[model samples]
Target: MPDFLLSQLLVSVTLIIECGAMQLKNKNYILAALSVSCFFNGFHYLLLEQPTAGYIFLFSSIRFLISIKWKFQWISAASLCVSLIITVSTYIGILSIIGFFATIFITIGSFSKNDRFLRLMMITGGSVWLLHNLLLWTPVGILVEVIFVGSSCIGYYRYYVAHKPSEP
Candidate 1:
């Protein structure tokens, strides 16, 4: 198969996995699903010759899995540091910087104990990722980020907004 075709396939699979992950109620389950999605997404970026984005996604897969077991601030800090290293080492351009910040938001959110905050961070990261995908001109990636952000917003509203006590 052509590299473009395969890249699209991988990102499509990532889209499916991420969409499902957004609906998950448990943090561990969400991280598990995101880990798989990030692996596929990493390959998708590599196939497209975006090494910086590719490595970041690959590292994110591991980070998400580790976060499931250890939701510590230090772990989150370490993940950010590693992401920075990956970005600097594989620096492509401004996109690398954008990808780094996006990863930072997602990494911090992943390590948090609050589910609502996680959803919010996912939305924020997804927005930044959307820009990166748009610039890359990856149709599936752009679609996935749009859906990811939308789903996160819906999840946030469903779980947090709906459950909030009414104002007196």
Candidate 2:
């Protein structure tokens, strides 16, 4: 298989797992799927020679695993510090900054208990990633972001709009 196709296959798997995660009611299951998604996403980025983004996903996968037991504060603090270092060291351009913030947003959002907040963050991060993919000239990455955003929107509608409490 071509290198790009293989990379896209990894990203495709991540997208499928994310779709399943959005449909699940259980937070643990969602986190587990997210961890796997991160692993595949990171591997895909690595294949594309985007080491910073790849490493961020790898780090996020580890974060998700630790967050299965650890508190949010610890995770956020560690993630912010690591993100800063990676961003500075990578120093590509606008995309690096976008990647940094997107990673942080996704990291915090993934651990949130509020469904709306999580989806909101996902949308925000997905937007940034969309731009990053465009700049990086990665068609697969762009497609993944579009699909991810669509999934997040559907999940948000189902969880927040369809199930909203009626006001007294």
Candidate 3:
């Protein structure tokens, strides 16, 4: 199979896993699914020759694992630190910084207790990712970001808006 097809297949699976992650009521389960998604995403980036992005996500999975035990503040701090290390070491250009910030935003969202804040950060991160992928001319990356944004909105509605008690 072509590299694009293989990479896209991985992304397709990641999208499905992300959907499951978003719909769950249990935070642990959501994080577990997110961990899996991140792993697959790392491979997808590798296929795209964005090894720095791949390394960032692969390293991020460790933070997610730590998130299971540590507090949100710790996770966010770890994420930021990792981003700085990756970005500084790689130093591709301005575009590389976008991935770093996006990683931090995603880490914050993943650990946040607030449902709305989680989705908002997800949308924000996804938008930045969309721009990055577009700049890289990565079709699969572009598709994943677009779908992720739409899925996040749906997840937010289902988990928050739809479940809210009707006002008196």
Itemize residue pairs with steric clashes in candidate 3.
none
Model with the higher TM-score, candidate 2 or 3: 2
Each model's TM-score, in the order given? 0.95, 0.88, 0.85
Question: What order do candidates take by lDDT, descending?
Answer: 1, 2, 3
Give lDDT: candidate 1, residue 119. Answer: 83
lDDT of 3 by residue, 49-137 (tens): 77777788787777777776665687678677877888788767766788887887888877777657877788888888888888877
Poorest 10 consecutive residues by lDDT, candidate 3: 159-168
Compute the lDDT for candidate 2.
0.79
**Cα-based lDDT for every prediction:** 0.91, 0.79, 0.77
Error of 2 at 56 (Å): 0.4
lDDT of 2 by residue, 1-168 (tens): 887889998998887777667666555666677888889999898888887888888888887777666647766788778878987886767777888988878878776766567678878888888888889888777887887778778877877788884431
Question: In candidate 1, which residue pairs get closer than 3 Å at backbone N, Cα or C atoms, i.e. clash?
Answer: none
For candidate 2, the TM-score is 0.88
| Winning model by lDDT | 1
RMSD of 1: 2.4
lDDT of 1 by residue, 1-168 (tens): 999899999999999998878888887999999999999999999999999999999999999999999989998998899999999999989999999989989998999988878888999999999999999999999999998999888877776778673421
